[model samples]
Target: MTGLLALAAFEQPMKRFAVLLGIGSTVCVVQGWTLAAMLFSLPFCVIWAYCGWLRTEPQLKWLNLMFAALYIYGLARHIWWTN
Candidate 1:
């Protein structure tokens, strides 16, 4: 799964959005924008999770599912508490 993600970094289609979103997420994190970073990464995680499901890859599927859950939790917290 780790190797798959590494190779996806160089592969097309996946490369296009994944790499850009990854960089954007990193930039947001560096700028101390936690919510923005999660927003950027959420789609990436969801997409990979779906791909993992389609491919029947449990590790990738569960890992991304967990990440997506965390991001959702964080976003919900930010939204509910920031008001």
Candidate 2:
């Protein structure tokens, strides 16, 4: 689920690059490499989400929020609880 969430983030021109990184991050997350995933995907996800908000696209807005939440949860889980 987290992987899929991460996979949803992308933008044109950089879409292909972002997708590849997103997939790698998703794989890291799925493999219990939460730290690596967070370090890798957090920036891209933030940028993606912010870009979504900058546009008039309603779907991207909500979808990015959802993905952001999932990323946050994943980060928090690793930070405060998974320890």
Candidate 3:
């Protein structure tokens, strides 16, 4: 009971945080902070992917998963190959 209550309490702030990160990621893109934006958006992509899976939304699931894979690959290449 207490655990469920705690989880419920924690859920909203995390959702809000994820949303802010998404918005901030877009703003980063607009401001030409491409790397920062991608970094911020990775979590958003992952979260949405999970949500899509839980809700059985195939389109959303696949799209987000694809983006997440691409973002991860790009980030890895940038971090490893560039150095």
Ranking by TM-score: 1, 3, 2
Alpha carbon deviation, residue 18, candidate 3 (Å):
2.5
Instruction: Flag clash pairs in model 2.
Output: none
Model 2 lDDT per residue over 11-78, tens place: 46455556777898889879998678876686666656655655546687677677777877877887
After superposing candidate 2, which stretches have Cα over 4 Å from the reference?
A: 1-20, 26-32
**1 or 3: which has the higher lDDT?**
1
lDDT value for candidate 1? 0.83
Mind giving the per-residue lDDT tens digits that candidate 3 earns over 52-79?
Answer: 6655778998999999998898799888
> What TM-score quantifies how close candidate 1 is to the native fold?
0.78
Candidates 1 and 3, the one with greater TM-score: 1
What residue pairs are clashing in model 3? none
Instruction: Compute each candidate's TM-score over C-alphas.
Output: 0.78, 0.56, 0.77
lDDT, candidates in the order shown: 0.83, 0.68, 0.80
lDDT of 3 at 83: 90
Model 3 clashing-pair count: 0
